[model samples]
Target: MSLGLRTLWGWTRRLFPWVLAAIVLGLVARQARMVEWAEVWVAVQSLAVSQLALAAALAALSYALYASFDLVGRHLTRARVSVGRSLGTAAISYAFNLNFGSLVGGLAMRLRLYTRWGLSAPTVGKIIAYSMVTNWLGYLWIAGAVLIWAPPRLSQEWLPGALVLRGAGVALVLAAAAYVVLCFVSRRRQLSLRGHSMELPSGPLALLQATLGGASWLLIAAIVWTLFAGRVDYPDVLGALLLAAVAGVLTHVPAGLGVLEAVFAASLASDRLPVTEVLAVVLVYRATYYLMPLVLALPAYGWSEVAARRRSARAQAVGDAPV
Candidate 1:
């Protein structure tokens, strides 16, 4: 690309998050005007203590599953790092990614932590690529399964018919299957693009990736469903969650912020569960899953940074002292 084009692309990527946030907020504002705020508030407050505890527990499990992404990445790349450090890095990186934009926040955090732990830049990049592939692999698997078996009712204005949903589902499943086939077919187990090479994990690792990734998404969907206290069936909620998550990711908004709520509200709008209640559930889920992790991760990350600096300074002083 030309220099001017590159600069423009950079600027576009930076501003896109804010633009998406504005669009999501506008849609949400319109939806908000349709519902009574009091009812939403009452519904949120009505959540039982046991329900809240269960949601919290599910949130913990969901993040633990996320941490496994790094474990898989490390194993694939053969990067050496302590288990505790790897888990911490994954948790903190994801926490930031969930709040800030993934490209800017999550990648930066992972690069820093992984580098500090002695991994080279290239290895970190590969780990990132592997993690992303693993994550999306799971998404496609779950999304395809949901659409094929228990497709939810989409807005007529958006999707014209059930055939389109089924076709899309088939395409997603095929895409995932293609990747698996590629992993097995390639003797070298590597792919090169634009002068950069990427090594695919073993077939066994790929299978594990699909299993773990799918399980993580299932756990996350369960977290959202638990908040509903069985108001909606698991299949419907899983379908909607996958759709909303995909939409959020495509928007490139930080943590998908308002975009997730808007898509989720639109997807689940019905007489049995109004948009307002759905929005309320989404807000609580975001707090428990997204914001809470960021809150804990920031402090833990900060402490690690400070401790590292202190240790470095002491080593330098010791080295410089006369014997």
Candidate 2:
């Protein structure tokens, strides 16, 4: 086989899994009857400006938390990239992640921009890795908080599911921390620290970043819950949110698509919130998290594409010109 054909085959191999995952998720969503477009439209229309604003704030908070991870990663690597660069990449990457099933699409976009800014592949890889790690650490933080706060927030009868969720949260936290320590210890200096001129500090500052990063994610969750404060009555709003998060992770679907809806429905139904309301809240969440970010991303994507093509064309013309 030709080298070009082999490259094509490899690309196809990479895409097959995403295609398969999408197909399976679509089938499950269909069977689950999770999508009722008419109802979703009604819920959307009923939303007041206040609720919409809260939802937007939630979306913004989520993005902020994400961007914070990039900032933390940059600091760790001692990279001189500006916060604005981090924010731009976060927006573009998130937009792609929401629409496309694979996180790789967004990561690819990030890598390209960072490379254009003179970042090396190892630097890019380390930034991406640290950002993801910090994000998950935030999940552990929220989960732990929900477990501790749920019982006090709600009645004793409502504590069972909360307990189960709390247990899971604690387990995830321990596992994630253990994994990070192992990676740090095993990799040592071989670990890609990016192109930072300064070495990452070991003690207090590192601890602070991880802690604040986790707190930022919880703030995002609070923003989401605030949007539908009166619409749904889960025993523990925070706990349910975290549970939905866990379900989303388990689904491995981008933006937690069907998985979020399924887990949300099951969790709310257990708490006796109406199916219609659960669907409503979930739809609102998606509108804020997915649709809004996507609309915001279009212009940035277009500009980036145009700029990139122009650069590519100039490079090619220069290469082909008579010397």
Candidate 3:
């Protein structure tokens, strides 16, 4: 009945479905012989020093993409929060996104930080919304490029598959772009969505913010793809990595575990890439991109939580000491 217990219960409940989904996918992969344990081990052991260096660089790029959120948030609010504070908040959000499954938790944390810096609530909401728009638009750009340029690398018989993918990718890009435009054009419109107030960010400034945000995400994809090529067995760098990036977004599972692997496997598999190579690629990609960041994030998350608790305790004590 305690708040702590309730929080724990809530997290467990939310996690159960995703955990089950992962188990089902794992079982299916096993049945299909999609996993070769030997290849996984080899991939891990075969990683060279150069590959490790590349992985580190890629991680730095990923962190750089994350910093854009804080940059944009501060610029939009025109607040006095320093770049260092923004970067710290960004790191905290990255840690949250890895553990908590969605950008919702991370965005909420960012909003809270802005609030502490005296940003208006509505402005913070607008900034966050635009930020999402930016990131999604950037993703669409890469997806579009992949769909158009990638099919030539696959077999002619797979033409229909390529077309279907391209169509879907194009649709996703247009839909996301349209949403941002609508929100921008209708900013002055006060509306209710199921009784919740909705404010539109219909402005040129909003568009600019979204554009910058999208560019930041593209930089992140470049980092991962750059590292992924060196670390894995996939032959088609641009196409395969683009598909993996798209899967990362669509999967919505924390860190895009199942979805990314499944897409990475399928994209390469469709091109008749060997299963052994596919597993090698996926394993290395996951190790450097997913696992390593998680390990680093644990310590960062611990430090942030400790600092947050201290700040809260101090505020509470100060409130209680007043006459």
Q: What lDDT tens digits, residue by residue, belong to model 1 across residues 205-260?
A: 78888888899899999988999989999998898889778667766667877777
lDDT of 2 by residue, 37-122 (tens): 57656765776788878778767877766666777667778776788887787667766776664455457877877777678877
User: Which stretches of candidate 3 lie above 4 Å from their native place?
Assistant: 1-32, 77-80, 107-125, 151-160, 169-217, 228-238, 241-252, 269-273, 312-323
Off by over 4 Å in 1: 1-29
lDDT of 3 by residue, 1-323 (tens): 99999999999999876775665456435534657668667755765677668767866676666667556656755657778877766666665565565554456776776666567777667556545656666666556655655542444422347678778768866776676677667745554666655444446655665566556555554544554454433235555656555445544556666556655555555434455566565566666655677677668757766877798899899999969
Ten consecutive residues with minimal summed lDDT in candidate 2?
151-160
lDDT of 3: 0.61
User: Per-candidate RMSD vs. true structure?
Assistant: 4.1, 8.4, 8.4
Best by TM-score: 1
- Cα distance off (Å), candidate 1, residue 307: 1.2
Alpha-carbon TM-score of each model against the true structure: 0.90, 0.72, 0.68
Model 3 poorest 10 in a row by lDDT? 151-160
| Backbone clashes counted, model 2 | 0
In candidate 2, which residue ranges exceed 4 Å CA deviation?
Answer: 1-31, 34-40, 148-165, 173-201, 231-235, 270-272, 309-323
